[model samples]
Target: MALHFRTLLAAAFLLVPATFAVAQDNEPDVDCDNAMTQMDMNICAHRDYETADTELNAVYKKAMDAAREMDVQAKDMGEHYVGAVNALKRAQRAWIGYRDGQCELAGFAARGGSMEPMLVSGCLADLTRKRTAELKTVYESEN
Candidate 1:
């Protein structure tokens, strides 16, 4: 009877660790894949936003360059090339305003919480990616 009790105790100890190991396996490693910890998540969110912002900057430059070329061609028809480029600049400025206000609104979901910045950054990343695609489309169709 004592031997049986000892065996049960040994099995229980082994079971606990095995279960814990399995649970840990499901969690992402902090090396590259995003870990769910707040710090890691926040870092990952900012990284994503930075990448999106970088892409947006590149596309914006290309689109602006296309506008300049279009304006140059329009000059032959006695139409000012500066007009179209100026219009695009105005649109881009308005977009910047909209993006800021929209992200601020999203941050409200986590207002006063530690995750507010993450929420705002994530929203910015999403919107920036979409805007990059839109700019690319316009640039493509124009040229």
Candidate 2:
């Protein structure tokens, strides 16, 4: 009886590690991929937004340069033209207003909850990425 009990105890100890390994394997990935808590989700969402915003800024600079070039060409042509730079500035301002308002509306889907921030930030990131692509299309089309 004592030998049988000892055998069972040793088997149980060995199986415990295997069980834990399987459980861990089934778990979510690290960092944002494993963001199970609301706080972590919010943080990941904000980080995503920040990355998108940075990309947008870079593309916006290139777009602004392109617009300025267009303005110069129009001026050299001696034709009255709506300034490309000015128009781009106006459009960007309007887009910013729209993005903010639209994100706020998205947050209302989770209103007053911990997930509100995540929803808003996710929306912001998505919109910013789309806007970045649009800017690239407009300014870097030749490339």
Candidate 3:
């Protein structure tokens, strides 16, 4: 059981980069209208992306830790299983792509509108919540 958990945890960690890459790639290019204000806009945009990325990274780390705990438990149970690790990795990658696309689409509702930032932020929050639920389900099932 423990070994199984470790395998799952390792898999989850390995999968995080792909998700992060997708999220980063799909991030909208923030425009700066004036050279004088370019630094400020860049800073604000960077801060926003960093905040969102940090939250998402935290979720991934938590999932990985849970997987590790599950692995330890499985090893203790003497099951000696090694199933679904690759599947989990693939699923995680798919999920990242899904999240990026979904969030980008969500942002379109307020394109060129004053609420664009709000729309995008809301979309990100929604995705984070959904992803959290998915991870919870995976962790619960392992138990």
Best by TM-score: 2
**Per-prediction TM-score to the true structure, in the order listed:** 0.74, 0.76, 0.48
Would you list the C-alpha lDDT of every candidate in the order shown? 0.86, 0.90, 0.66
Over the full model, what C-alpha lDDT does candidate 1 score relative to the true structure? Answer: 0.86
lDDT of 2: 0.90
Could you give candidate 2's per-residue lDDT for residues 101-131 as a string of tens digits? 9999999999999999999999999999999
Q: Decide which is better by lDDT, 2 or 3.
A: 2
RMSD of each: 15.7, 14.6, 15.8
lDDT score of residue 82 within candidate 1: 48
In TM-score terms, candidate 1 sits at: 0.74
* Candidate 3: count of backbone clashes, pairs at least 3 residues apart or interchain: 9
Q: Model 3 Cα displacement at 1 (Å)?
A: 68
Q: Show where candidate 3 strays beyond 4 Å.
A: 1-56, 66-83
Clashing pairs in 3: 1-71, 1-73, 1-74, 1-75, 2-71, 2-72, 2-74, 2-75, 5-71
The residue-level lDDT of candidate 3 at 49 comes to 59
- Can you give the lDDT of residue 7 in candidate 2? 100
